[model samples]
Target: MYSWSCRFGLMMAAIFAVSSGQALAQTSAPPVKASLRLDWKGGGQHAPFYLARDRGYYKDEGIDLDIISGSGSSDVVKQVGSKAVEFGIADALVLVQAAEQRVPLTAIAAYYQRTPIVVLSPQSKPVTDPAQLTQGVKLGSKKGSATFQGLTALLAANDIPMQKVTLVDIGFGVQPLLVKQVDAMMGFSMNEPIEAESAGLPVTVMAIADHGVDAYGLMIVSNPDLIAKNPALVKGFLKATAHGLSDAAKDPAAAVAAVNNAVSESDPARETKVLDRTLPYFQSDDKEAHGAGWQSESRWEHTIAIAKKLGLVERDLSAHQVFSNDMLPH
Candidate 1:
């Protein structure tokens, strides 16, 4: 037999060769194809997905991700529930409503920790409180919207009768509010508020969450079929997505840059403002203590209760039935 040192050297070489081969195989394997549908057209709110795509986070998890712009959150929920796509980002309350209708959607991660709905009024003549919205106030309302649903919930919780204020129907523009056609309007804090401010119309924003109507906002959703059939893929996608969100939060400029690079029609300056306003809503007491995308059951239960009051859901739903924290990266 050969000396001990010679045998040990040969064994070491064999182990190195095996490990190298494994590493090469992993690097060379074709990435699995995946797609993500957004709640709306690409904007600053969606920068993390683009950032993830640009930084190869999905690729690192063997996922070839294609991000698709969508018409709306409800439409996205329908598409994902129908199994037309593997994943989607949508409003969490919308997901609960869909689930009540026997949709197969399950929220895998909480993207926004708080609702962004706000009552917008000109700062000169502000509607400071919900109680102030009584006296024949012409409240601009976009009916059949997620924010409208939130408005209804706020009214119910605060014991404000629907008849207390006159609902002025408006389209998806701030012109109605700017021209004093309506005293106040319901819109997202990030969208209409930013638009109004940019147009030199500073607004008095009353957040719904601050007025006893708290709820989880947008979330990452997937179907049970995908979650059951390919659990690893689900976990991998969440891991990559979480990393992308973390990176986006840390370097918003880079995130905006990545989004602009991907979408030719995107406006950088406007998107920058939107992203700046959006980043704060991503944090919560539970998120700070646990980690990103951590859902608190009590908070979710409260949201479901609000959905029930708004008649968005036909029946009661438990918080656990609509979401799962299994996929989030620890």
Candidate 2:
């Protein structure tokens, strides 16, 4: 027992045992087969999604959510609608648009309580008023983005014709404003603006929530057949998503750190700013009263009202046909 050789061997074995135990703990969870496609790249709005993966939130709820990047919200919705994917983090407006076309997808639960749409530009050439932008101001937005749709609604509401101004399809991010390609750009505030500001560019954001377009944002979507066949799975997804949002709200810096682990650490400061603004959407007066998940009555009615007024919907549809509160955890 007192021999140096024996002592050295025991010490090495103990070290190996501890290392092996840690490795097993980190790698023991079985891979789940769930597939989720996101319309946007990683950001604060995506923190809950990243949290669901990193913190074992989805796995704890018995789902192996395999979230992936997607081309756009329309693509995400189309894939989920076609049963090619189990879940999609997509715009709430896309569901309304799909229902208008009689597509058979349903929103199980919502993520952002407020839409993430925004008009990003430099403070020098800002679209301070939605109407003012059409006064020969150049604009940029993704071709089919929710914000682009809202931009149309905003112009209609303000009596500004779109053709009078420029509407360039700048893909994503704030390339137009940062590079001075366009006077203003419309996209996700928590995503593009935050990204632009972090990249050392002076950026100003006009969130649609602040711009009089307070529509519901990202929601969890699934095929209606899946909802009828396995409602429990949908409920679990919502509960986990809601829980992840709540946790992120309580400790956003740590939440961003968790997200940063999945993404990049170069922009933690900017990511936290976006998270702070985005968290309030998760808890509205209705959500506080109705528990978690999308509020079917008030929120849906407002969205439909806006869609109808903006001519985005042919006729008003019942909220029940589009969204359901039954999947939410009571």
Highest lDDT model number: 1
Q: Candidate 1 has what TM-score? A: 0.92
TM-score, one value per model: 0.92, 0.78
User: Candidate 1's residue-wise lDDT over 1-330, tens digit each?
Assistant: 989999999999999999999999978999899889999889899898899999999999989999999998888898899889899989878888888888898998888898999999999989878998887679998888777887898898799998887898788889998888999999998899998998889999999899998898999899989999999889889888888888989999999999999988999999999999898888889888888888989888998998888877778888889988887778
Task: Report the number of the highest-TM-score candidate.
Answer: 1
Residue 283 local lDDT, model 2: 73
Model 1, poorest ten-residue lDDT window? 309-318
Cα lDDT tens digits, model 2, 1-330, are 479999999999999999999999877756446787887667776787777677888888778887677787788878988899988877777788889998878877767777867777876666667767867777887866567788876766567787876777887666667778888888766667766776777667776666676678878788898889887777777788777877787778778887688775437877788788688767776678777665666778777777787677888798887887788888
The parts of candidate 1 lying over 4 Å away from their true place are 1-23
lDDT of 1 at 23: 100
Model 2 alpha-carbon miss at residue 128, Å: 2.7
Every candidate's lDDT: 0.89, 0.77
- Quick one: how many clashes does candidate 1 have? 0
C-alpha-based local distance difference test score of model 2: 0.77
